[model samples]
Target: MSDFLQQVVIGVQLGSIYALIALGYTMVYGVLRLINFAHGDVFMVGAFVGFYAARALKLEEQPTLAGALITLLPVLLLAMVACAVLGLVIERLAYRPLRRAPRLTALITAIGVSLFLENAGQLLFGADPKFFPSVTPQGAGATLNLGGATISKDQLVLVVAAALLMAVLWYIVQRTRIGRAMRAVSHDADAAALMGINTDTVIAFTFGLGAALAGAGGMLFAALTYAKILPLMGIAIGLKAFVAAVVGGIGSIPGAMLGGLLMGLSESFVRGSGFSRWTEAVAFVLLIGVLLLRPAGLLGRFAPEKV
Candidate 1:
């Protein structure tokens, strides 16, 4: 029972990471109907940016909490900004031209962008993984006992931070004027433009928003795992986040979050059952299962075509 509880805690923490990444996927898809496969790489880039900034600033060597935090905030902000710019560039350079092209063409372009980013990261950051500076101070570990289960401070922090980010995204998407414009464009781009909305700006805003979320997720992931940044790190996580978006209901904001959390927990449960080897195949299996069960996903609603 204790083991089960511990796994659940871990699952929620990991799921938060997935939720963050999946939000980016779902947001881009909702607006453009494009997968934005390069999004995973955006997360990768964020990790690298944070990693390098910390290394350059010697964040790990900071002698005081205030010093470390002073450096961490700026680095995180810079990483997020860089990722947003990268997202905009990709949209303009690779996807914008293919907007009127066939879906297959756009997909091919996305794959190309993904490949380009991976190789480019390797060239720039090198093939070796580089560690990120610890944002959580040393010896900061705390635990809460829950029915014989222990939840660590790190897990708690991760879960809360992710929830806050998701809340902010939800507010922006559901409450803001720009969000309304986004929805208008999503529903009918031409109609939205006819109403005097700048569709290009809306599209760019969507990409920037998604990129920012991915950047935050990348930072969270690195902090939780204490893992170094790597070029190919985005592929697997990206695939999983994509699966989460599909499972919860693609294009639905709440659905994406739910899908991500559920997928993470499901993976944990599956691994706990002694099927650890099946972890890699879980996303594909879930995707196939969900498609078979509900083609539109759990919350996805199809729009009626105009005759």
Candidate 2:
């Protein structure tokens, strides 16, 4: 029971990170039906931003709750803003022009953008790895233990923060006017525009939102386990999150969150049971299984096509 609880807690913590990153995948797919392969690199950029900020501010050498928060606050804001702008630019410069082209064309463009960003990032941030300062205060790792299961402060923070962010996203998507426009655009961009909705603006905003979320996830991930920010960091994580989005039902906001959590937990269990090598394989196997069993995904419903 203790071991089970431990794995569950760890799984939730990691899953929360995946959930945040998965939002980027689902949001872009929902709005534009385009997979922003570059999103993972946007996450990588955020990590580097946080890394430099921490170093410049001497955060690691002088650790305090207030100090860490203050140092991070500005860095996170800047990273989000930067990534959002990048997302908008990518949409406008690379994707919009190809909107009328074949779906394969758009996909190829996304892959190109992904490659460009990775090489550009390597040049800008250097091919060498940058170290991230420890944001989790000392002893925080031993702060909580229940029934022989320890819940580090980092895990608690990740879970609670992710839950809060998801709640806000749910409210925005389900209740807000902008969200309604987003849904309309997602359903049919042409019809939405004919009805006076600015589909272009909606799509841009969707990319911005997704990029910002990915940026935050990147920062959190760096704080948790990663210290080095590489241009290619997003590739593996982004791919996994994409799988999670598909597993939960692509284009379903809630489904992305659920799928991310499930993927993380599944991977965690596999690792805890002495099958660490299968972690990556498990995600793909699950994705293929889900696709085979339910082509539409767990939360996705089939929609009738217009004649």
Best by lDDT: 1
CA lDDT of every candidate: 0.83, 0.82
Task: Report the number of clashing residue pairs per model.
Answer: 0, 0
How well is each residue in 86-125 modelled by candidate 1, as lDDT tens digits? Answer: 8999999999988889888998899999999999988988
Candidate 2 accuracy as lDDT = 0.82
> For candidate 2, lDDT tens digit of each residue in 150-243?
8776677668767887887778778998989998988888899999998889998898888888887887777666556788888888888888
Report RMSD (Å) for each prediction in the order shown: 2.1, 1.8
Shift in Å, residue 181, candidate 2: 0.5
Which residue pairs show backbone clashes in model 2? Answer: none
Stretches off by above 4 angstroms in model 1 are 61-71, 139-141, 304-307
